[model samples]
Target: MNWDRLQEKLSILSDAAKYDVSCSSSGSKRTNKGGLGNASFSGICHTYTPDGRCVSLLKILLTNHCIYDCLYCVSRKSNAEVKRTAFSVGEVVSLTMNFYRRNYIEGLFLSSGVMKSPDYTMERLTKIAKKLREEERFHGYIHLKTIPGASPELIHEAGLYADRLSVNIELPTQKGLELLAPDKNHKEMVKPMDEIKQGIVQYKDDKKNKLVKSMKFAPAGQSSQMIIGATQESDLDIVKTATALYKKFDLKRVYYSGYVPVLSDEKLPALNTSVPLVRENRLYQTDWLMRFYEFEPYEIVNADFPNLDLEIDPKLAWALRNREHFPVDVNTADYHMILRIPGIGVRGAKKIIVARRYGRLTYEKLRKLGIAMNRAKYFIHCGKYYVSNDYDSLQLRNLILHSGKSKYTKQFDGQLSLF
Candidate 1:
């Protein structure tokens, strides 16, 4: 193999793949049955696992050459500044084996630009994964970014080998796609998503009915990504789209990538404009609320408030908006109501439920249980001990902000006070 040429491709393709944040290896239980590697259910890429161990994946694109001229994409065909490159199937297989042997990565995350066509591109991706699994006996995790217009047969074949498959929605709304990415549409994207979803369901049903003994079709399940701040879609629009996709597709995750404004275009954001990192973070927090905290999309963002409050989290914003729900009685409130209290998470709510059974939970006991008392005190009350005064929402907001800052100031002063 040409080492110098392969290194150049690695530099270009790996850098190109950095924009994709949907490449997680979690939820896969592909064991190493006399293979090169194992994909544990706890493993995730560039993120902490449930057991607090951080794992890595060899994330790279199959190629950067494309046919479409997307205004938001750096790898668009019109972009002459980006150095284009491609990797053969064998080279990708070789690279995965080499990286795994050296302990550089626990798994592989492979995505690609549309080289010639979607099927043409997806075929190469599937081949690389097939070679890794069948020929090389590599049981490591593999995440393939499914092309939108790829044939369903190819997509089904890809799922049989890949641990997780993701189809990037790219933009949040159809209007954004029409403006920046004219060639793409939501229909084409949703097709592959539906196919992957059905495949996952069918596999589970077949396994349960004892119709199939050894069949794995994307065992980690499929996820998708949407780019934020590229167009005029409001946070409400994005959240609604995400909620629909999650319900319709049964997705494992819906990743949000804040627009970086890498390329200059008439339709895209200005290159100098700040990336919407806070908005993206807030959206992820809202997503967690919907998925884990049982928050409905309307409850988080609706016609009254279309966007998230960047200053505070979604749960706190919700509590502050509906002041009638505040000052929940920790000792008497149900699990779901206790979950809605600001600064109290799922674990804390569970602990309160268990602790209150033995005895009433006081403010001090709640603080001892690792609840953020500074924020929770205003929203919760124990028996005969009201922690919050009759302050309005606006006043409560200011007080909370001030108290947080004051705590930080006191900590800083104690470390550096000259007196």
Candidate 2:
């Protein structure tokens, strides 16, 4: 009942929330001496989900009193040593309003533990979201984690209030789910994903809702997460699951969290620390190909290799293995072909499309269009210019791997160009 106690609970639950992969803030840095708000580079950031989506949100949980004891969870019901608390519907609305009024965050991201029961828990979540929209009239972004197997009616109603909805696929395989989260079923998770996708599509495609904001059903769309290194599943297995999720669920983003031993439970893989950061990074790269590059899951990971290389990114690794696809003439290649180049991105692909429309694109023109020529050179041939023809693939692979060190730093330094 005490407001101070509520704030303390928020601190405990939110700090317990730091490991969640879905909520990382954008890499953008801000120094807030006098502005309305400031952003930290790491820790509790405001990421825009995926694509050019311009929404940022304050990510938080409703309660940490989870009934299920997922081994990796900090608030898993069995975790007696940690703090446990729940926010009343009004408490959540109040905190969101105060934070919004003070310009601390743009909106709310409210997920919850399986408190009490699924229906009761979902009912509580619905209450908080409904209050935020109706009672408080809070119009900022809202992303709610839809409970799996909740009633279709409740799921339908949720789309009306929240800007985005998500259902984490949790583990990549059914075997992993059975071993780790004993209570949850893969079908139980997939059903809600299908329904959310259908609801959003039905809302947008139906002509009957012409005048109705018809509740812009998750205007930002849905997303899911997979915990990496939680089981013996291969990287290929994880990526295949991710690829299917995006294709079937039309997921906006699929977050991959590196596994950490928080609970020290019996079922979890005793991966002492988490899987190395490189593994998580590679999964993200493969996920990018599935979503944007139109690359199939098997194209990158197959029977021969189930994991990604720690030294190089998936695309570059793929490119190095198949040099026949490279040395593409950026001057004459298609948009899809240009996208396969190491340094060029979606914007650069667009530039090539448009610039080529005006005239033949040359190497000089690529630089002006904001392409990273160093990474692009090996993959592209413009006019008469081509990188070394006798270039050793292994040597080239090493060259690409070494250059990755500079990519992130140079990205911030403006030394490497991008779209």
Name the candidate that leads on TM-score. Answer: 1
lDDT of each: 0.86, 0.74
Candidate 1 segments exceeding 4 Å error? 46-55, 266-272, 404-419
lDDT of 1: 0.86
Compare the candidates by lDDT and give the number of the best one. Answer: 1
Looking at candidate 1, the ten consecutive residues that score lowest on lDDT are: 410-419
Per-candidate TM equals 0.93, 0.85
Q: Which tens-of-lDDT digit does each residue in 349-403 have in candidate 1?
A: 9999999999998767897999987787777767544543455778778868777
Q: What is the C-alpha lDDT profile of model 2 across 41-83, one tens digit per residue?
A: 3334243442222335666678888778777677877788987
In candidate 2, the residue pairs with backbone N, CA or C atoms under 3 Å apart (3 or more residues apart, or in different chains) clash, namely 25-45, 25-46
Candidate 2 residue spans exceeding 4 A from truth: 23-56, 207-213, 266-269, 403-419
